[model samples]
Target: MPPLLAPASRSPWASLPEDLVRLVSWRLLAGDLTDYVRLRAVCTNWRSATMSPCGRGVIDPRFHPRRWMMFAEGHGLYPGHERLCEHTRFLNLDSGFFVRVRLPLFKDHCVLDSVEGLLLLQRDEDTAIRLHHPFTGDIVELPPLASHNLHMSHPYANLPQLRPISASVSIDAGVVRVMVIFIHLMYAAVATSQDTKWTYLMHWRLPSHYGPLSFRGEQYLVHETMNIENTYLSQIFQLEAHSQDPPKLIVTFPREKLCYPVYLVECDTEILVVGHNDISLTHLAVYKLADVVLDRFIPVKSIGDKAIFVGGRNLCVSSKALPTIVGDTIVYRHPREQHFMQYCLNTSSWSLATDECSTM
Candidate 1:
């Protein structure tokens, strides 16, 4: 009777049907992960209706791969002796937008690879390798690199400079593999999730300059082979994990002139070999693997509304999914430069991302 004087008015947003809210959330999630996070943070009702980005962890296939790159801001007294700030800054590849997020994971870890929204981290002066989900604080531990046998084999081994070349994780299968190069020892080591120690693989004649490239659901490692004629050819080998058998030679490309280093990348379910110059990649050529059995590659003219990111891990994404990002272009950062540079495949020209500035 007391409340009969007036009826409480309900907010329209809060009263929205769950089905409708979920539909909108799906659309936002399909477009961008940031939009989905913003939608969930609006209200409790909205949050309840929408699924979490980290609900299934970073390994979930439903979550979108990160299109943004993390950058560290320089601080301290001078340029040579500057210290990096703890705060994390991410740059969106599509819109070139910058966002600041607090991530405590970077405090003591070094990023080895960024794959499928997960980071491979190694702590300073620590031999343990771990997989970290930056947002959800989920951690997966892998086998350490240091062991008694390693020290016995290499008396002058420096464990601190363990440079991880590539890392891959499969949460469902409980599998994780890391490939690291030992500079001082001049060999490559493979650490499997199942093994407690590392396996050493030494190729005295042909040294691998880059990591493994996955194509057609199989892992393949590409290495440059020099012929007596002084021409470089890319040799593809089938990689077998946890096996004593050596890698089998699959196919070899035709002898051709080489640039800085050839890289293998997977794009749109196809494998591509990218060749570029060392100096800011002034010249670049892309070729698609037309026939694996024949060891043939067709010159690729356009990637078709898709953009490729070349770095530690090569990735291809549809620009149509991100309207602001230009299609048919390659985005990369020079080791000597602090900003990103874009190379238009269609126009055959290069342009600097003036607005997008960050340290790689």
Candidate 2:
């Protein structure tokens, strides 16, 4: 009998059908954009079989770095000319990639904060606030700053310099909720789609620094205040859903050890207060709120295997999530020098991040 013909040889990956290749590409959804881009560039057939990962609608939850800081470079010369300039770069700490993101909305507006993949922007001309999604080019116009009852007649009200101290957004089931605090306003305002006017929530005292934070499916505001005795206090106010009443103050604690320029960040379901001593450069103190009502600020020497990045806003991540990121460290940009620095919790040491993209 004639020898059986050897089966035709086949390359493992090359032999994968178009549908299988597409399925493999979808797996890259959990990876950084760089990896996704590279996967498509592998070959013409593979590229044709898969679509770009960035599409309309919510991003896949599996994406490694859910948030990114889109840093704004200076505006270009001429009217609307800056739109073409690739000045916006997205800093993805997870991938350590400074990918350029082009969005005309960023051209004339100043980015106030970035949360949940949305940007809080203030127009340079009128200081009007809006919510914008840089990647998807979606914009939601918020009530103009003039529409609010800011009590502009107050002596300390600086209308010209008036801007949001901090802002946050929560989107659920096609509904959007936005909260903003003005620098000179004694109250915070909330805006929802159902309401035409901003609902103001009054506070007992004006917060020196404040930001909106959400926990356990409820909206809350984190306030930092200082008394006449120079004692610093951190408080939490619970905002009621579908209620016009003012937010209730639920938690209060003293942060006497922390100095001025302190900021609040929610990480892993816990609130953290980060403080720095202007005179000291070697270390910064990080306090975790152990008990919202009963306990004082608990000193934390380290946040095991996690690194917190604080800039226009604060972001926390596990070092294992991004091998390039150092653990037990706080990364922040120096306000004066405009350079990025890292503070080691274990050693209580400070050093400049040598990575070129760290500055952005």
Candidate 3:
């Protein structure tokens, strides 16, 4: 008979190296807070290694966090899950995680846009705009639309139909600045805490859609226009911080290749202009600004591993952020329809996504 071997002892998790434990903890940071807490409870070494996670762990560039499509008004449907509650639902395509976020502040407000996890809300009663963070529960109110003169001769009823088409926020040195554009009025308004009233920029209308982009501590309003000769031009305006001066035109597209319905997106610390062909609405042209001062836009075939979401608001995210979201794709909702559509950059194809409200 073989000699009896001593029972092997189980290695304690606390014996693991601190660096290894920290690396494992970093991955858990993207998950729910409860999961991170549970991970730290496993052993003393892990608890000490992950004690400084702050709120959410720093996002890993190589493996980006999944991007979710947040419904502003109603709930979203997952492929295999039951219907979610109303208010706001974030649907993760890769993991099929449909989460409903309750926002008491948004009960009677219309969601105008979403950026960097912040929702731009407009009140139904008086068109009061505010920014609310669903995750942090922080709210910042902007100057009411009623404060600004619509310049209309008669009293305008149905103010909700004239909601601001675009809104953007910037924070610097612990100060918050917000910009809102009212397309019908052809006006852009800026408000800062130091100012007693909102500053208005008039006669700054673009023929097509426009949005705001904050880059490198500067605020820019980007839009497209048509010249007298029927040429398409992409325009960029630089808004001076806390200044009452009108926004200055800093850049314009050098060529007439682009069409209407242009959108500006900031990706990888650079600016990208997206334009759709008006005739077909099938082809999209993407350009990268090589030199903003020179107003140069170089055509590009692909946007690298980034997927852009454009509609009432514009968002750019990496494909690695969500496994099911394909790279070099554009996801947008039609203005007239309730369904969502996706455009593939590689194949130049169009397809409809699952409609969340259709089931209701």
Q: Which ten residues in a row have the lowest lDDT in candidate 2?
A: 56-65
Model 3 score (lDDT): 0.60
Off by over 4 Å in 2: 1-66, 72-87, 122-129, 149-159, 202-206, 210-247, 254-262, 266-270, 276-287, 290-301, 304-306, 309-326, 331-342, 349-360
Weakest lDDT window of 10 consecutive positions for candidate 3 = 57-66
Candidate 1 lDDT by residue in tens digits, 1-360: 445432224456876788999999888876667787888898888899877766455545445345666544546322112143445666665555666655666666667766555667766565567766655556667666564245335552555445545444443454555454453344556665566777667543224656566432235667787778887677766644333345578767665423445667777657776666333556667876556446555567798888887776676766754565678888877444546778788988877744634444
Q: Each candidate: what lDDT?
A: 0.61, 0.61, 0.60
Give one digit per residue, the lDDT tens place, for model 2 in 23-55: 777777555445666888877767888775454
Deviation from native of the Cα of residue 237 in model 2, angstroms = 4.4
Instruction: State, as a TM-score between 0 and 1, how close model 2 is to the true structure.
Output: 0.61
Rate residue 142 of model 1 by lDDT: 69
Q: Show the lowest summed lDDT stretch of 10 residues, model 1.
A: 76-85
**Residue 267 lDDT in model 1?**
73
Model 3, runs deviating above 4 Å: 1-69, 72-87, 91-99, 123-129, 149-158, 193-197, 202-232, 240-242, 254-256, 276-283, 290-296, 309-312, 317-325, 331-344, 347-360
In model 2, the clashing pairs are none
What TM-score does each of the candidates earn?
A: 0.65, 0.61, 0.62
lDDT of 3 by residue, 1-360 (tens): 977755432445667888888777766755544356578887666788776433222121112222445743324343212343334566553344566666566456767755444567778787676766554455666766666655433256746545755555556554567676665655567775345456666545433335666444345666666679877676777765455566777777644455556677776657777777454566777777545456555567787777888765567766665566677888776443446777788888877754566434
Candidate 2 has an lDDT of 0.61
Model 1 clashes, total count: 0
